[model samples]
Target: MASIVKRMKLGSQGLDVSAQGLGCMGMSAFYGPPKSEEDMITLIHHAINIGITFLDTSDFYGPHTNEILLGKALKGGMREKVQLATKFGIKRVDGKIEVRGDPAYVRACCEASLKRLDVECIDLYYQHRIDTSVPIEVTMGELKKLVEEGKIKYIGLSEASSATIRRAHAVHPITAIQMEWSLWSRDIEEDIVPTCRELGIGIVPYSPLGRGFFSLGPKVVETYYEHDYRKDLPRFQPENLEHNKYIFERVSEMAARKGCTTSQLALAWVHHQGGDVCPIPGTSKINNLNQNIAALSVKLTPDEMAELESFASAENVKGERSWNKVYSWENSDTPLLSSWKTVE
Candidate 1:
């Protein structure tokens, strides 16, 4: 019941959160079927007990289940102890996935999340995916109003391009930009990472453990349940999996030399990125959470960082960071505000 994690500023704009966050997506959906609500609540409480309080979730995660679960978990004064974050803009309609970022949808989603989360204000709210058709300014305009109204504390964007980030930040200061940045996922480094650093926005790296690949290694693919969504990702396919296993092997060898587990080393690499960067690594079990938290202690020298990078350099890693091309940062730019017209 003692604090094990440190608190750090996520962005220059006065938003502070735990050094690392607990990603709550897997507890309700994506990785597999829904876990027992009772057990997940216990896991959530345990995370807070150990100081991993920057909890992240999205409305589309279960299409709603995840937020409701967090609402329940944060009851009995638990909500007062954490910096809760949830996202919107990704939805499913008639079995198809869609992303929305218009002012109307933004306001509606914020209201709905406030209700679901049972909180007066959200610590941070993000557009889960960019809506290419809507102008970033328009979406952020509404979010700015929310900030004025005290509906949300700060704005954030996930999987957004450098241009979109600038436009969104011009409308309202972006506290964080959540993206997939891990040993195997380094495409953001070319532009997005630098843009955020220049603009003083924090980087929240989701899937910091390579979606569980670094933790369990290649054979872990065999343990995927029938409904596990990871099975659909190309990197885990038999062909790509064969090629990717070596990256894990090399990382494992380095981890052994570093006196830590492969998962810890992989996460530590992200932690070493800088104090402005925070990685939200998700797990369904307490032991895994402990291992991830321990990653904060696995320091690496510059050579070790570069050597780890060599193992899973983008070219060496197979498959796209996203299964759907549209969901990635490359395709996340929105129309200019000057070119946007509202449909009545």
Candidate 2:
């Protein structure tokens, strides 16, 4: 079957996936209450049929439900059509979030995710958050074993610092680095982006639409549902949002000049970052998914790219990228390899 979405090599490794992946986190968790299972299944199928094959989700999303949902959606011979990616290491226990990367936990999580995803081999598996308690090498050692066991084909790290990425890649060549990278979330560009480029690792930018701010604008905040977590995000707070809205406004103005929707232009910017980049923008609605796919066609020249960058330069943007300090890339480094006994 011909694919509408062009495929690219995600890393120097043999892992190739669609140019743009589908982030399935919102379908079962985070943004709001769980969406209808039937609807999400249909949406996943629609994405695959349209050639958006790289599906991203995590056990942390819906705790466990999202993987189960993907398992269901991949039935009826659909699993073979796309690259499946899921994550582990972040768990909510007793109302507190904990990150673990011990070898025992790594093996358990991988086995559990395999069962939940109902797949023989996961194409890409990422440590959702760096576990500071364990050495990066120790955690990656277990993942390296998974590759040899054929449990996972490729390894990835999320929200990792340049140093941590370097350390983890030494243990096992990291196929990709998943980070929050959008127009407003540009901190990663200074170090993380350069590190990945230097190591020849592919970068998968999550929240490439700035958590929907660039698309829906400040007015969209008023429509948040009761459980909408975005309402509590720093950038979405009334005080910061008042200032941040201007960034969206400027992006909207440029988008209008380009004859595209604000969301399309915002997504296009990520698409244009480079061929090594693939942005996973999540949407529960088919219309939004189609619109995001159209972003691949919204080409940008060097001058326009610089103009867009100026609108959301770090100084002009307000609020922290994440409310939790644990998620900051600066805090993503794990302990030194010598700090822990090497696993045999």
Question: 193-299, model 1: which lDDT tens digit per residue?
Answer: 99999999999999999899999888888768878888889999889999999999999999999999999999999999999999999988999999999999998
Candidate 2 lDDT, 168-250, residue by residue in tens: 99888999999999999888888889899999999999999988898788987976888888877888889999999999899
Which one wins on lDDT?
1
**Candidate 2 C-alpha error for residue 113, in Å:** 0.7
Error of 1 at 157 (Å): 0.2
TM-scores, in order shown?
0.98, 0.97
What are the clash counts of all predictions, listed in order? 0, 0
RMSD for each model, in Å, please? 1.1, 1.5
Candidate 1 worst ten-residue window by lDDT: 335-344
Q: Provide the global lDDT of candidate 2 against the true structure.
A: 0.92
**Candidate 1 C-alpha error for residue 56, in Å:** 0.2
Note the residue pairs that clash in candidate 2. none
What are the lDDT scores of the predictions, listed in order?
A: 0.93, 0.92
